[model samples]
Target chain A: MYKKILLATDGSKHSIRSAEHAIYLADSFDSVIELVYVVGGEKSKEDVLHSVDKYEVKREREEKLRPIQEQLENAGLQYNSHLLHGEPGPTIVKFANENAFDLVVVGSRGLNNLQTMILGSVSHKVAKRVSCPVLIVK
Target chain B: MKLQNLKQDWFGNIKGDILSGIVVALALIPEAIAFSIIAGVDPMVGLYASFSIAVIIAFVGGRPGMISGATGAMALLMVTLVADYGLQYLFAATILTGVIQILFGVFKLASVMKFVPRSVMVGFVNALAILIFTSQLQHFEGEGWIMYGLVALTLAIIYILPKFTKAVPSTLVAIIVVTAIAIFGNIGVRTVGDLGELSQQLPVFLIPSIPFNLETLMIIFPYSLALAIVGLLESLLTANIVDDMTDTESNKNKESRGQGIANVVTGFFGGMAGCAMIGQSVINVKSGGRGRLSALVAGTFLMFLIMVLGGVVAQIPMAALAGVMIMVSISTFDWSSLRNLHKLPKTDAAVMLITVITVVATHDLSKGVLAGVLISAIFFAAKISKVKVNEIVALEGKKKVYKVHGQIFFASVNDLLDKFNFNDKVKEVEIDLSNSHLWDDSAIGALDKIEMKFEQNGIKVTYSGLNEESKHLKKRIGGLSKASGH
Candidate 1:
C-alpha cells in the first residue's frame, strides 16, 4: 500500500541491491520512488571548510547515483533525487518522518548475527525507533 | 620527535604518575605480604617480589596503572608447586615459567587473549574469589569474636576511610590503626610474626640446587605451565582494565614481556611467581596514580618498608591481613554478574557453572578454563550443525532453486551432498546463501568437495543472494561467476 517509497543509498556494495529491491517494490505497488543520499556531517563539514575540494565530492556523489537513476527512468517510475548532509540512520528517519513516505529500505553488511542483535545495525535501529515499518535488505 | 616536546610530555605525565604511585605503594605493602603467605612462601618474599616487579614493570610495562606484583592467581598456582616440590624447586620452576611467558610475549602471542571466552573469564574470577574467601576463613577460626570484630572493623574502615579522607590510602590506614590497637590492647590474635621470621635483606639471587631430577621436574612442569597461563591471563586482563580506567592503551606484547621479566627476576631473587594485580592497579588508579613514576615510587617504598620497617610491620596480626584479603576477595567476586548469568543462554550458564565448579573443586584454573572453552566450542558446533539444505522448485518457470538452509561444514557436508539432484532435466541449481552466514575451514573444505562432485556430474551451480562474506565461500569452491560486471 506504499504510495511513495524512499530508498537510502550509501554506495556500498549491498546498497546497490537495496536500491534494486526498492525499485522492484515500487514498480509492483505503482509508487513514486525517491533516491536519497546522506553525506555524513563529518564528510560535509570537511568539504565545506576547504579541507577537501567540494566539487570533487559533489561529482563523486552524482557518479554513484547515475546507474540507479537510469534504472528508475527505464522502469518508467516517477523518481526524484535528494542529497542531505547529516548522520546516516537518524538523517534517514528524520527525512521519513518529515516527508510522509510509506516505506523505507536499507541494507546491512551481515556480520555476526549475535553481535548485530546485541548492538543493532542501522536498519534494525530504523525498524525499532521509526514509526513506519522499515525493510532491512541483508 | 622534538626533544623539548618529548621532555615536556614525559615530565607532564610523570608528575601525575608519581602521586598515583604513592597511593599504590601504600596499598601494595599489606597485599604483598598477604599474597606471599597465600602462596606458601614466607611473607617477606612477597614484599621482595612486589618491590622488584613493581620497579621493573614501571620502566618496561606498557600500561600505566598495571601494577605488576604477587597476585592471588599466581598464589593459587604456587600452592601446587610448594606442595609437590620444595621451595627451591618451586623457585626454579617459576624462573622457567617466566622465560616461557617472555617467549610468548616476544612471539606476539598476546592476541591469543581474545580466544578466552567471556563466560570462562567470569567463571575464573568468581572461583578465585571463593578460593580467597575460604583461605581466609582458616585464619578467622579459634581467635574468638575479637577476630571477627577486627575483620569487620577493617572492612568498615576500608569502606568509610575513602569517603572521609583522600590523602591516605584506606587499606593502609585500616591495617595500621587495627594493628596498633591490637598490640596496645594485647588482643590475643594471630600476628604476621607468628607465621615466621621476616627476612630483612633484599631477595638474594641464588642458583636453585634441585640436582637434575627428572621426576621432580616432570611433576612441577604441569604446575608451572598452569602458573604461566594464569599469570599471562591475569596480567593481560589487569593491563586492559587499567587501560580502560586511565583512558590509555597498552602494548600487550610489551606488557607480557615485562611480566615475564618480572617473574623470572622474582624467582631468582627468592620470591614466588607473580603477575599483574588488578586490585592494586585499580587502587592505584583510584588513588590518583598517573604514570610509571607512581609504580617506581611504590616499588621503592616497598623495599624501604621491608628493610627499615620490617620488624614493626611484621607485628601486624595475620588476622588483619586475612581481613584485607577477604575484603579484596569480595570486591573481586562479581556477585552481581554471577547472579545475572542465570539470565544468559543455557549453554553459557552451563559453561560458566562448569568452569566455576571445576576451578574450585579441582583447584586448577587451567582445567576450569579448558573445560569452559571446550563446552562453548561444542555448543557452537551443535548450533551450526542444525542448519539444513532445502530445495524449492518454482512453478512459474523451470527454475530449480537449491536452498542451503543449514551451515555447510565437515559435520553437515553429507546432508548437502545427499540433498542435491544430479539427474537430467535439472536446468540450473541456484545455491541460496541468503540464510547462511557463518563459515569455518571445514565448511569451506566441504564446499570444495561439493564443487568437485558437481563439476564431475556436469551440473551448473550458481549462488544467489550471496552476501559479501559468504561470497568468499564461492571463491573457495572455485565456482563463482559474478552476477554483475561492475
Candidate 2:
C-alpha cells in the first residue's frame, strides 16, 4: 500500500535505526525513499558550527544514511537526502504535509501521554497531529 | 558597610522609593483598620501592628518591597482566638505563635512551605475570601440603605476613578468621600467611633498574663499552632508575590525570621498578630515603592494618622471600612486559579474541593492545607509505584541473554532485583534501557550495588540504549560506557 516513505532524522542513533527501517521497507516494496535531517533553530550559531566541526554528529548522520543509500543504489531504488533547519516536530510535519508522503516512520522513547505532552516528543506530536498514518518504532 | 548601602543616595532611585512609600501609606491606613477589625481587636492595634512590622521587615527581611504587616489570613485566625479566649489571651497566643515561627525560621524550615500544593493555596484563598465577606455582613445590618449607598459609592469609585487619574488611589478616594459624607452630610451611617475609640499613642509594651498552667497552654496551644501555620503561609505567599512583582529574589528563611521578629514585637507592644500584607505591597509597587523608604513612610503615616488625626480617622464609618475589606477580599480570592483548578486532574480537583470545604466548615485554615498536602503526597507516591519492570530471556544455542525492563527506583528496586534468577543456562546479563526510559538516584544506587554483587559472582553485565541518566550513572561508577552506535 505504501510507495514513497519519508524518514526524518536528528542524526541520533535511534533516528539512524529508523532510517535503516525506512530503507528496508522501501527496498521491499520497490518504493522511493526520501531522507530528511533537521537542525533546531533555537540553538546558537556557535553550537551549530561546533556540531559540524566535531565530525561526531555528521559521522553518525552519514553513517546511518550511507549504508541505506548504498543498499538502495544496489537495489536501484529511487532515493534522495535533504537537510533543513528549524524545530524538529513542526518542521517534519510541515515537510510531510507539503510533499504528500504516504507513510512517515519515526522513533519513540516511550514516554507516557501526559509527560510527552509536557516535555514534548517529536514522534508523539507527529503521530497525534499528522494526517496520514505514522509508525513510531520504539 | 550596611550603612553605606542604606545611605548610598536618595535623590536618584530614592525619589521613586519615597513616592512609593507615600502611596503605600495611603493604601495601608484603610487596610490596617479593616484587618484589625476582622481580628476583633481595636482598629488602632491593626494600624500599630502594621507600622511596627513594616519597618522591622523592611530592614531585616531578605527580599525588597515585601511589606510585612497584618494580613487577611492572620485576621481570620484572630477571629477564632478572640471569640474563644477573648482579646487578652489572643495577645498571649500571638506571642507564643511568634516564638514558634522564630524557631521554625532558626531551623531553616521555610523551604518546607513549598510542599503546600498549588491546589491548597487556591482553596485557602477562596475560603479566606468567603470568611472575610461573611464577617463584613455584620456591618451591613440595621442601616440597610446607608450600607448599600456606601458600598455602591465604593464600587463606583473603584471602577470609575482609575479610568480618569492614576495619581489618586481609587480605594483611598472611596474611603475619603464615603467617610466625609457619613460624618458631616447628615448621612445616617454607623461611624468607626460608634464601635470603639481610636487611640493616639504609640504602642506600649504590655506583658500578657498567660496564667502559666498546662490547662491554659493546652487550650491556647492548638489556636496558636493554627495561627503560626496561617501566618507562615500568608507571609511566604506574600514573599513569593513580591518576588514576582519586583523581579527580585528573597531569602525565604530570612523573611520567615523577620516575620517571627515582627510578630513577637507586635505581641509585646500590645498589638494583634501580623504577617506580610499583600494588598499594601502591591499598592506600594504600583506606586513606585522600590525600597525600605516606602515601608518606613507607610508606618510613619499610620502613626501620624493615629496621633495627630485620631478624630478624623475615627470619622471613617464602619460601612465604609466594610466596603474596603470587601474589595480586599475579592482581590484575594484568586478567581482565575479556581477556574484553572477545575481543568486539573480529578484527584487534584477533589483535594482542592476538600480543602475549601474543610476550611469553610471548621474555620481552620491550617487543617485544610495539611489535608490537601497529605492527599497530594499520596497521589505522587501511588504514581511512582505504578512504574513496573519486566524480565525477558532470549535463548541462543546453549546460552541465554537476560534483559531487564522498566525504570528502577526505590519503590520498584526490590521487585526488580527479586525477578533476577541466577541459573546455569544464563550466560549474559544485559540491563536493557530500550524499554526503560528513566532512573532516579535510588535506582542508580541499586544498579551499582547489583553490579558489585554480580562481579563477586563472576557474572558480567552489559547495557543497551542506556539513556542519559543511566549513562551518567555508568560514568560515575566507572563501568563500561554504553553508547548506541549508529
Candidate 3:
C-alpha cells in the first residue's frame, strides 16, 4: 500500500534502527525512499517555514545519510534526499502531506524526552497531526 | 513625492497614537514615581523626566511608534550618582550624559548593533518580561484572592474584548472597567495614590547650579558616561523590540540622538536622565499606538493627570494597573525562544542563558549585554579556529598535489605549517586552495615559509587554487606580489 516512503531521522540510536527498518521495507516493497531531515527552530508557520544557514546543515546531512545512502546503493534501490527546516515535527508532517507520501516513519524517541520537551516530541506530535500512515520505530 | 505625502507617511496613525499615548501616560505615573524612589530622588523628577522625554522623543525619535520615558534601567544606574553627588551634580551629569549620547549617535553607535547576536536579543526580551512580571507580583500582595480575581478578570477583558470592539483598545477598556469596579465596590487594596503623591503644579525651568568648572566637570564625568551608556542601551534595545512587534524598521543612530536631546531638556526641567521604557512601549503597541502623536499625547496626558485629573488617577487601583502590566509582560516574552531552546546551537543557547541570568542578577542591562557579546565572541573564535588543512596526494602529470580545504587565519596558520612536509618524494608540489580563504597576514606568512623550505629542498612549489580574495591579499602582502598579475 506504499509508494513513496519518507524516512525521518534525527541521528539518534532509535532513528538508526528506524532507518534500517525503512530500508528493509523499501527493498521488499520495491519503492523509492524519500530520505528527509528537518533542521528545527521555532520559525514555523502553519505551512511555510524559514531555514538557518544551510551549508552547515548540508555537511551534517551528508554525514548522517552516508550509511543509508550506501545501503540503498548496494541494494540498487532509488531514493531522494531532502534537507528541510522548521519546527521538526510540523515540518515533517507538512512535507509528507504536501508531497503525498504513502507512509511516514520516525524514531520512538527524538533526542530523548528532555530535549524534545523543549522543542516538543517529534514522533508523538507527528502521530497526532499527520494524515499518512506512521510507523514509529524504537 | 510631495511634502504632503511625506507628512502623511509620518503621521498616518495619529488617532491610534493619541489613544495609545493617553494609556501610556496613565501607566507611566506610578512607574515613574516608583523608579524615582529607587533612585532616591523626588518622585516629581521622574514624572518631569518622563514628560520631557515623551515630548522630545516624539519629535526626533527614529522609531515612530515607540514610547520613551523614565525607566528602571536608567534609575538603577542613577542611584549611585544621586547618592555620591548631590542633585545639582546629578543635573550637570545628566546634561553631560546627553552630550555624550549625541556623540555616540554622531559616531554611529548603531554599528555596534551588528555584533549583538540573535540569541542575546531573545534573552534580553525574555528577561525584561520576567522582570516586569515578577515586579508586578509585589503589588498583588495583601490584596487577597479578590485582587487576584480582579487581575484575572482584567487580563481576560484585555484579551477577549478585542474580538468584539475595535474602536477603543481592549487594554484601555480593561483598565477603565477594572478601576471603576474596584472604586465603586470600595475595595480594600492599594491605589495609585499610595505609590506617590503627584503635585498639581507645572515644572519650571531650573538650570544646574554645578558651578561650571574643570573640577566640576571632572567630578560628574564618570557618572555621566555611565548614564549615557545605560540610557542608550535601554532605548536602542527597546526600540528594536518594538520594531519587531510592529514589523517596521527604525533609524538607530537617530534614536540615540533623540534620547540624548530628551535627557538634556529633562535635566533643565529638574527631571532625572531617562530612556525608553520597554513595558510602556509594549503597552502602546499592543493598544494600537502607531505614530509620534501617541508619544506627545502620553506626555501631555501626564501633565493633565497631575493638574486636572489627580483625584481620578489616585482612585485607580494598583491591582488594575498590575493586571495590565502582567498582560504586557506575558505578551512581550518570546515564548518561541523556549520552544527552540533544544534546537539552537549549544554555544548560542549557553550565551542566551548566561545573558538572561546576568541581567536578572546584576540588574544592569549594560553589563549583561557586554557579557553576552564577550562570551559569543570567544565561542565564535574557538569554532572558526578549527580551520583544517586537508591532504590530497593526487598525481597530476608527475607532481604531488596537496589541498588545503578550509579558511586560513592566524589561528589556523600553525595547523597549515605542521601539515607541510618538504621531503615528499616529488619534483614539484602544488598546493591546491580552491576551497580555502586566506584571512590574515600569518596565513600568508605560513605559505611563504612553506614555499621557501620546499624550494631549498630542490622541489618547485606552486599554488593551484587561489581564489580572488586569497590572491588579492597574497599579492598585497608580497606572497604573490612579485610573482604575477591579477
| Second chain TM-score, each model | 0.87, 0.82, 0.81
- Clash pairs (backbone) in predicted model 1: B17-B291, B20-B288, B20-B289, B21-B294, B387-B406, B388-B406
Q: Report lDDT per candidate.
A: 0.76, 0.73, 0.76
| Per-residue lDDT of candidate 2, residues B43-89 (tens digit) | 87788888888877777765676677777777787686787788778
lDDT of 1 by residue, B1-486 (tens): 666733432354675677777777778888888887777878877888888889888777767556888788878777867766678887888788888889988999988876777677778888888888887877866678888888888988887765456688888889998999888999778888888679778778888878768886787678778888888888877776665444456688988888888878888888778888877877776565666777888899878877888888878988679878988898777665655766878987888789899999988888898898898888887877776677788645455787777676666665666777666365556778788764655566555555555656776666677777777655665423222211
For each candidate, report its DockQ versus the true two-chain complex. Answer: 0.02, 0.01, 0.03
Model 2 iRMS (Å) reads 18.6
Q: Ten-residue segment with the worst summed lDDT in candidate 1 chain A?
A: A45-54
CA lDDT for candidate 1: 0.76
Output the number of the DockQ-best candidate. Answer: 3
Best-to-worst order by lDDT is 1, 3, 2
Output the better candidate (2/3) by TM-score. Answer: 3
Error at B4, model 1, angstroms: 7.3
Which RMSD values do the candidates have, in order? 15.7, 16.9, 10.5
User: Candidate 3 — which pairs collide?
Assistant: B17-B294
